[model samples]
Target: MAGALLGALLLLELLGGGDGKNEELRLYHHLFDNYDPERRPVKEPEDTVTVTLKVTLTNLISLNEKEETLTTSVWIGVDWQDYRLNFSKDDFGGIETLRVPSELVWLPEIVLENNIDGQFGVAYDANVLVYEGGYLSWLPPAIYRSSCAVEVTYFPFDWQNCSLVFRSQTYNAGEVEFVFGVDEEGETISNIDIDTEAYTENGEWAIDFCPGLIHHHGGSADDPGGIDVVYTLIIRRKPLFYTINIIVPCVLISGLVLLAYFLPAQAGGQKCTVSINVLLAQTVFLFLIAQKTPETSLSVPMLGRYLIFVMVVATIIVVNCVIVLNLSLRTPTTHAASPRLRHVLLELLPRLLGSRAPPEPPRAASPPRRASSVGLLLRAEELILKKPRSELVFEGQRHRHGPWTAALCQSLGAAAPEVRCCVDAVNFVAESTRDQEASGEEVSDWVRMGKALDNVCFWAALVLFGVGSSLIFLGGYFNQVPELPYPPCM
Candidate 1:
């Protein structure tokens, strides 16, 4: 019982000491708490993000002999850090963010120094830089900074044979790079994984690393790596074949069509037939020419213009040929007024537009009894005039002319004026008939000669024109596909 009491007393004292220790700890120490719930104050980094960049181009432009400027646009891509806390959006969902509003990242004026020719001020001019894709978003899980870069280069003349080189220095990033190879069929070719051959999304993008310039054409993650990507594209100057097969044959047929004018209508079966054949040939050529040329509403080709000229000329030939045939089919009675006009306008105009004189009016026949009496008088007067024994005979030949003609020669003989009028009328008709006969033969000869001449001209034109057209086509064929200007970067 005594030991128990001592233990109780000790325990009470120990409890009292523990109580005192608890009171002391409570005065100076505290229990574990959610200190974060106490709302500790913090400061965010400045919203202003600074960026500085310099770009240099190497061999990005080419000039003609005159050094005239070629226009081109370059694309620059930059990836950097932007210190922004928050951003807004518009109803259209466009990122509504504040822009720093500075030309910190810009293209500097580049001056091309051509030492060989000592030409200056012939380089990149002051051109506006079009910006794209520089916005901020705050909806992500974490607040991350964003950055971007652009490709700033120029392609000199037509982009078909131009290359653009762009170099950008990002002060914030140590060395950031990307690879651009021929995106063949959308299959990317990389320097490291070049062995892996891939296809394209479509057949068009057969992107491949240019064989010769590859060493300095591709990009690398390391600082000293180089990249060059050459995109060889096949674009036609005009969407049609400059072919002799088209132009030569067409020109030749056109030349042949010109031959139609030389064929005479009097040739019966052959003349019209030949002209029709030539017309058909020309039609074939026109069809062929249309096929050979591009199907565009653009201006007609020089050759087409010439062919049209030929066709028009040929149509005239055909029309003249028809006229000639009409003249040939005409009877002497129907053509009595103007036989010469018929042959000339109808026949000769087919060869060339030659003028003809108007024909004489037809003679009116006297009554049968009057005609017999005049014939008897004419024969008697002619016999007597030759004898010089009868004055009436001399007068008869003299009166063969018209009354007007006889009156003019009235002093020559007694019955001369009347006799001369009769003889003159008869002689006029006879001479006209003789002239018609001679004209017919001459026209025939002329027609044949013209056909021959036309044949010669057509053949000559064919050979010469064919040779010229062939040379043009051959030159185009041998001509090299223009080399694309591929800079070191792209």
Candidate 2:
């Protein structure tokens, strides 16, 4: 008897649950039996349907600077009143909410207006939530690719203001009104809502501000007005990636240009080579920057301008290298050093450049009289005295005085001519030696002038490089992101 009673109670409970489910099915059919999804669920045709739009930012997918597009993932919450879907809860087991297919109800046909790929609607057809008080809410997830104009003036350290515009495609401003959603405290929110728990942070970008604004377009004779909600997402680039990969390398390479000037002028080949390499590196960096930014002629990036400045400096260094090399290889025979050039390069400039002048060549010494010539004369005199009277006879005539008398006259007259010839030979050799020495000294002075010019150029390049680099990069170092993405209305 106890088992039979228990079985009977269980059967009755199952039957009662089945009847409740049947009533719920009857409610679904009753709501959609005469419902026309194409018609707006309003009592009057002129009545405006106010839609409250709220966005839950899920992820910042990517921002393509080259294409000027922003791809994001968000959940669009759209809420409005629908008089046709309303019901009395007491007639259907007190059901307060029902989840029904979104196709069986009227939709606002809201879409992304500034989409780049022409895909405007939500990604999924998700169910609609209907309440007993004729209120409908739809939360659909969408991946939007919206157009965002990029301002690369301070790129890699710049912040961008990108917007996602939403509007009703099938309704005009007179028939639809857009409003921002309210928070739990009933205050209208002006900014995009971030779901911290579900939001995934982007690697290269950081969110700064995301404000939503409602705009009303007034109708004209030919154009119909519409209501739109604009959600502006302001994001700043992380900068770490670009700084490490592009900026740091470029700075280090530009420093090499200064080192090229520091090198001695004798190494003109090496100096020119270094400058050319730096120029090539800047070219490569410019190409890399171009790839990352859009192709626009309105403004050049700060980094690009810096690269161009460095290239210009490098080109100047290369030209200076040619001048230094030409001066180095100059010779007095080929290119004479003028009086003014000599004074500047060898005298005044050398002193200013902290260099010493080339030493003057030593004067050639006068040749000493040969003792052998004197010995030759003395030997001739002795030989004349020893000679017979006949051998010493002059013009075959005997001397009336003595043998020594004739020999003395003969030796004096003949030896005087030989001594004159020896003196003339010595004088000629001395003059030739002095002339060679002077030529050598002139050649050395020209070489000294080349070195002096090199010193002057080195210091000049150093100063110019220092000043140019400081001016170019200082502005970037002090660059700061603005507090607001756009200017506030006056």
Candidate 3:
């Protein structure tokens, strides 16, 4: 670029006479000396002047989906005629172009109407090219932020159509009117030209075509008309990022919710804990999506709907957990199992479910103590037991009676206190044995209820989960397209 500029200066110097004066130098000096850049071609406010503008989109800075903003940098070119500065190439020694500052001409107050921030600054002062006749051209580079409508119906796999609109701010249609200049190839309308190699490909979005439109606002020929240029950019989002980060994990957590039914109530109530955890995890994911989306409630996001569906299933699983636990812990003593229910819960269900049946109600041995052991206790304890031992053969005889005779007399006196003590001990042990047997039966009922309740819930939850996930995701999958502008059949 430096070399090119140096060569152009050398050519200019050669064109001028070496004696420091020539017709070419005088003609160049006369053209600008009388020219006023501030003057427009016409003075009337109602008169219209058509200006040709060339815009080439250079960079797509960003397209913020959540914020609904489109940021871009572009190179713009404007062309007009300056009648006062007319000059001929024949007199100027074949000099075809004149380089001058941009202030040397009138500039139309053009602006991007849809700009989000409405900033009025552009890339600083650049040179304009003037023909040997009266033709003038100015080119500048600028960055603009424009507002766009976000449609999140098909989010993560959605398509967006955004526009960059350019219009004259000061001159509506009278003083100045804007038109898209011929493309470099001289077509009436310039194409949305972008340098594809330099474009930054977003990980989340794929760029589609950007098409330009020249729009004319309805007005009579006498009235000033409104004209603007719009470049519509159509892009589609990539779903892989959302799928890997959000969908897969959500599905896994939802599957975990299904596992709650299989988790036995005997698993220390972990089934309920797991269901609660899954519910909470889904809530967290939904919150994250809310922060990244618009606050309007017109429609629910696709993933949000899926999470909500999973949460409902998780809730049902939690409720089922409660019911199963209640049944499992029900005691026969507090709530007697109906005879019919006992057959169904303890007998029929286990067979139908192909599961381990609970052990039958317990029964204690009929006799509290062995007869042989009791006989030995009586014989042996008579000598050893201090309290039950008799000290007399007669009322006052302590050491005279033999052991056989002492046992015979004790039996003979049925109402004797020693005889009564032996009967009470045997009866006390028998009553304890009956209490234990009843306790065993109650425990057995609890075990039966647990197995039956588990079977019931496992099947119920499996059905609910299958239906919930299928209906929710499938509905979204089928109706993913946005129904706007027109119901797209494509």
Candidate 4:
């Protein structure tokens, strides 16, 4: 009798515990038995369901300026009152909150309207939290790739105002109302909330501000189009990456352009080589900037403009180098230095540029008076011919050697014409040599002028580079991001 009584009490305890455990299962059946998930959880058909929305940014994936897209990781919190899901906690064994699959309930179905990809909904269909008093909250994580207009006016030093527009596809403004989520203080939140603890910072871009606003479009009593929530994510480029990789290197290379003019006129090849290299470097930088920016003809980036200026200067330097080389290599035979050009490049320009023409080579000293071989030969011939044959005699002998004297006179006279011809040839050669030396002096003047011109050009290029660089980049230096993410009227 005692064993039977103990067994009966134990069975009763087990039955009670089992019943308590099945309460959640029974609640699920009771709540969803007649629940029409298709119908809006409103009392009347005309009654509007207001959904509160809040976005928590998890990470900034990337912003593609060329593609005009913004990719981000975010969590969207949507809360609303679902009257059909209400339940009595006391009847369900003190259960207050229940988690149910999102497919079993009505959803606001807010989707990104400005999506670059064709897909519109969130990334996943998550669970919904149901409270006893008909309050439902759903937090879905999504990776949104939305369209954003990129303004590359400032470029790497630029700030952008991108937006994520969310709207309901099934419901119009009259059927569904959208409102911003409020904080614990009951104040409406105007900006996106950053998940600071979980947020990963972007290396290239920094968040300036992100403002959320509710905008209604084409909604009237007869025709209600829709309402959208615009989350404007204003971001400014960090600029450090571009400054190190693009801007600084470009500036240093552009500074090398001025060195071309400082090179001597004789080093024209070196000057041309440097100018071409600088131009090519600027072209490469321009190409890089083009790849980074959108392909638009509306405006050019500041850095690109500066690069173009540098290239133009480099081209001019190359042309000037050619001219300087031509001047240095000029000869009196081919290109004579005109009096005006000589005065400007050698005299006037040099004085104005605080320079002087190179000194001419010293003239060679005249040799001491000496008789030429031809002249000596001709003098000996004339002295022999001047004396008569009868008087011709050796100093040691006193005989009138008429026949031998006649023979010597004949030989000397015969060689006289050949000696005279040699003398005339020597005089002609001397005159030609003197003319060549004078021509060489004239050639030296042109080279000096070329050197003086190089000085003038060096200073001119320096001034132009300084002023042009300052003008082109000064605006970017002063560019400042606005405090507000978007315009106040927006």
What lDDT tens digits, residue by residue, belong to model 4 across residues 1-490? 3245335545656677566556766677677778888899889988999999999899999999889999999999999999878888999999888877888889988999999898798898888999898899999999999998888877777888899999999999888999998899998876888867889999988887888999999977789878999998988889888989998999999999788777778889999999998888898889889888999888889888889888888898889899989999888889877789878877898788777655766979977643443354454566567753222222101122355764654455455656445545676788899999888888878778888877777888889999998987787877877655444321
Model 1, residue 477: distance off in Å is: 1.7
lDDT scores of the candidates, listed in order:
0.38, 0.79, 0.70, 0.82
For model 4 the local lDDT of residue 344 reads 87
Q: Write the per-residue lDDT of candidate 2 for residues 398-485, one digit (tens) a residue.
A: 1343457546656653556654455566767889899887777776676566668767777887787678768766766666656775
Give me the displacement of residue 133 in model 3, in angstroms: 5.3
Model 2, CA-based lDDT = 0.79
- C-alpha-based local distance difference test score of model 4: 0.82
Decreasing TM-score order of the candidates: 4, 2, 3, 1
Candidate 3, residues 1-490, lDDT tens digits: the string is 4245435545767877463334445555667556665667664645667788777776667777677898888777788877766788777666667766666567786778888886755665677787867888888888988898887665555677888788876666667777777756877655466666655556665656666777878567776577787877776677787889988898898889877766666663798899899989999999988887776666677778788878887887788778777877776567877788888887788778887664656967686765544554555546555443332222112122555655666565444776556556676788989988887777767766776877776787778777876776676466433443421111
Model 1, 1-490: lDDT tens digits are 3245335545656677655443322321221111121221122322222222112221122222123232222222222232212222332134333322122222211222212333322232222221122322111011111111111111010112322222222211123223433344865332212112231122111222222222243334653443333222221233133334555566666566545545554653465576567667767767765664445453454455555556665565566555555545545344442466545444565446333334546879965664435765757745754644334434443446656654555555544566656756776889999989876755544444344334444455446545654553454444434444532223
Candidate 3: lDDT over CA atoms?
A: 0.70
- Stronger candidate by TM-score (1 vs 3): 3
Off by over 4 Å in 1: 1-209, 212-385, 388-428, 443-449, 480-490
Which regions of candidate 4 deviate over 4 angstroms?
Answer: 1-20, 88-91, 358-437, 485-490
Please tell me which predicted candidate would have the highest lDDT against the true structure. Answer: 4
Best by TM-score: 4
Poorest 10 consecutive residues of model 4 by lDDT?
390-399
* Winner on TM-score (1 vs 2): 2
